[model samples]
Target: MATRARGRGSGRHDGQPGHGRHTTATARPARTRNPLVTAPGTLATPADRALRGKAARTRVPRSAHASWLPSVDRPDPVAVLERQGRDRLPELLPIRYGRMAASPFAFLRGAAAVMAADLAAAPHTGLTVQLCGDAHLLNFGLYASPERALLFDLNDFDETYPGPFEWDVKRLAVSVAVAARENGHPEAKAGRAAQEAVTAYRTAIRRLARLGELDVWYTRIDAEQLLPLARSTRHRRRAESSLGRARRRTSLQAYGKLTEVVDGRRRIIEDPPLIEPAGTSDMAFLRKIFSDYRSTLSEERRLLLDRYRFVDAARKVVGVGSVGLRCFIVLLAGRDADDPLFLQIKEARQSVLEEHLPSGPYVHHGHRVVAGQRLLQAASDIFLGWMTGPQGRAFYWRQLRDMKGSADVAGMSPADLVSYARLCGTALARAHARSGDRIAIAGYLGNADTFDRAVTAFALSYADQTVTDHATLGAAVAAGLISAAPGV
Candidate 1:
């Protein structure tokens, strides 16, 4: 590993000196549970048609972008995927793991281009905004601001780009539909979740139209805070338990594996093929770079005058969809072992926004990642910065996990799903509204149902198509075309 000319102690309980909301005006701010939604039973017949049509030509409505290259009508589903797997998958791997959990919808996540291509095939209402392209079910989560105050917001930026705002909503709603299917909910009920989500988004945007811009920026929607809104005792309790757990998370909670420490000579225990330690020399260079990391931060942010130094670093695989990617967590120490700060630097691959988007090089795609993350997130990592790695790769750096948390879809019931989906929709709207113009989009949506119905139709259609693709993936696995864990 190369070095960054900056330094900070690792294993600190809270965060780096000034991450998240503590920073001045900059960047902002997956999974479903269940397995029984059948394409024939859950999706409208048209969705199956969508699943089947991968080669059809499509177009974006004139009002949306005034651009000519991208179209909305979809191609045959089978063929669309053939092109994606051949052309896109090779590049996106080392993708965030954990995202491709044990479901078809989960698998779709690791394949962002596949999702983008599928989304491109859907109908649009011409409403656009900067979108967090990979807004899957599990993506929204809670994280501490530099103040250590926790807030719920978008947590991933690998696919951030400007596009039809509806693309994010459609992707989000369809995820609800698929997750509902997985849960064996009736298709009608699943459709309701999708409907509720869009309605919430529409309503949230309109609500923002009434608030001052700064208010929008300062507003933090938190999950624990929603417990009061919970109508049922069950939801309230769950929310409380979840919040309690989140509030309790500290650096000590995360650094349990490496117990043997003397002079901060820690050893990270190997978790099999998943998280084995690299060579000793490899770690030394990583430490050397930790000292260099301090220079990477703006001098203003590089305060505290060196109370810490880098001690240990290791390779760690995390997130379902992001499992194979090059992810490293460097543990730092200042004055003592307990005062540690853990910084993770993950490789940022090209966005799916690249191939489908109008051609132009993203001068600083890493900068774009940092900027988009700051824009969309309520708070961000203190050490958040971008760097170029060896062998021509780009990476964005941040704290390993400071009071980081997420809503667990696996544990949610339908009513919980409804409330959570609404929360996500509302948050997504706020993110878009803050990053772009709420009025223009609201004007495009008008006091009408055109945007709602079009995307609802599209979400249902694409979800049906996703199941077919999932089956194809299953077949490919069966035939050894690709590989994943058996019974996955």
Candidate 2:
């Protein structure tokens, strides 16, 4: 266990101070509901107002963040990777390391736990929020809301939980910095991108704090709305191109590419390692899981789901960090062959942040993920729910691919990259404000670029660390110390 120097409390609710030390991972008493989200004008309190003054007066200045990174006895980054692989699929663990070895940015995405360890050692304001524990640049994307409208938000929640809001922002800042480097952008450009993300987060949270609570909760950035934020014609053009492609990426579109007629019926296409049909034992086990999942859904949703009958399922490998985790795609059909539904059943484990933050209130990690998603997202999947499997594994289920899309940062020019960075920052702030005390957080930030610059410096320094860590992983793969199946 590690401990960070507590700068000054935000005068808000008490977050786990000195989180680096060992904490209990067992469940605690359940909370009926989140108290941060309140009716208009009720989100803040008299204490919050006084705390704002206290924070602005005596809290550690943001500039002090420049020296937050501890230079002593840091844990071995390679050892951390090996530790995380312990419970993952042995055959697929190599692919996880291989993808991480692809580039520094890829490594950043796959190494959330590594950064979480570092962040636990850094100085932080004691402001806890339901954090997107792995809030890297790529994780923020466009997805279909319940209304069927495309909206921009944090799309990954595998590690979402209660932790310092700064952790999420720091991860995002480093990701932008690393992405810029991966694209061969100048160091100055990379620094500027990281700074812009911090600035956007600061500005957005301040604005949201001033608004009525409901108004802030209701706010969401739609795909079309983001175009106006682009700073240049090039930025706008690239965003439009990305948005156009996203609009066509519906469940129907995925059905065409991911399925085919097998004799007289349709089934998921097999692409060994990446996508393969389930075995008899797995299929039987999944049937029971599906029944438990249906019980978790609301009556209306269950009725809607009942209209479809289970057809088939397959093991599907997804994402860099989640590569070795157990994930499956289940197919269902309605009255006709054209009527289809795809549900993604992903295994849920304790959040990486749990080791450094407060333990979750939910007994099941699947419930923790679902509850956190609902708390952070402006709107979530109608099918989102969770269930425990016979083997005691927890899982969350959601629509497989309904108009989901992420930006191709590699293709973006430096200018466009900066613009995208700001968008991600804005999304991160919005997500935090939904489940955190916006007024308290805004007060801690003040109206200065002090924190912004400090975080940018941290991001760049951490980006360098990431490069070194990534090289270590690559070396391990080459040395035959670890198996690595490339070209997945």
Candidate 3:
């Protein structure tokens, strides 16, 4: 096995390749930067390292890569969509077509992990940390509680792992700035916003160092605290209101939209392709497996679920970035068709974390994702769990979007945008502190200014490449090398 190739269950095994955490923190100097970030991240195993050859050439600084990203005229946007869709097939039902037709930028937002692997592997001066691999402008957001309290946090952790801290921080700064530029903010203004994100990250890292290790581990950002930190009375009042609105965002709420009551039977509404059931064979198999799945759950959970009877299910497509991948939403009905419960079981592929770190003792990749996500996120879906089926494929289950919300990247003014950037910056560092040493990280960062400069340098440069990649896909589409049904 070459150094770059992480194999099945390779994530839990420490024997093979790069640095990574398995289930907990490691005892090591946090200040050490991986030479691989600048060097070739060649795995000890040649076979794995061979995969790194896809785009090994050196190019201009990442800051420069952004200039050409917006030139959609140079690339065929439709072809890019087709390439993205190609990976998402056999599982995509038709209802998600409207979502796929959402802007190219929206698609880019969902696929940031795909971008991170290409960018991080390009240069390997191995600055490693517990990275939020899918960091981007809109991924940061607020969630509320039953009592109507709002808390800010990093909402996505599907791609979090030990990797270059630069990758996480750079992705955020560039995303916010790039997103701002797309919204027509001035260049200098956009640059400053990016800088503020770096500042917040630097500031947060130091604060994390001050907390007791266990205290830091126990901390969570509460939604109700927004009342005291409110920038204005109006802001406070609005937060209080949004909190109330959040309570209604439940599985019950979602069930009403996705299913219906037809003569007292709770069934999913099928309008052509939008939301439909799986084929008869798949459904028949699932019916039996769901009974088996119930036995696998804890007695308490099993009893809780016994209240709801499993109904028919379908492979449902969801989210812009995940439009082309395998995803399904299973429906359950209790007592009456009106009392519905929805469970989202998304396919868990190997994480980008696996590529950077060697696998440990884990036998399943889904276990790795579930374990890593539980460790990293301050708030997680209550139903989070992992399972396997059909060729031993892995999947993690959760409530799809229970009270889930995102930042208003398009709506925020420059000032509010900077404020939001700072929020993400702090959250990213906090997540890193969970498995990586914050103090050693702070020492390496050493007063923040220099680290901030390096981050800004990399962020600006990589943003430029995303634009280039976008254009390359565009050209492929125009040349008829790929099939495209744009604005789907």
Output the number of the lDDT-best candidate.
Answer: 2
lDDT of 2: 0.82
Tens digits of per-residue lDDT, candidate 2, 401-479, equal 8788998888777888888999999999999998877877887887988778878887887888899899989999899
Q: What is the alpha-carbon lDDT of model 1 when measured against the actual structure?
A: 0.61
TM per prediction: 0.77, 0.91, 0.76
| Prediction 3 TM-score vs. true | 0.76
lDDT of 1 at 288: 51
lDDT of 3 by residue, 322-398 (tens): 65555667888788776777887776665655544544335665565666666777756555667776767766676
Higher-ranked by TM-score: 1 or 3? 1
Question: How far is 375's C-alpha from truth in model 3 (Å)?
Answer: 0.7
List, in order, the clash count of every candidate structure.
66, 1, 42
Give the worst 10-residue stretch by lDDT in candidate 3: 1-10
The lDDT of model 3 is 0.59
- lDDT score of residue 276 within candidate 3: 57
For model 2 the TM-score comes to 0.91
- Using lDDT as the measure, name the better of candidate 1 and candidate 2: 2
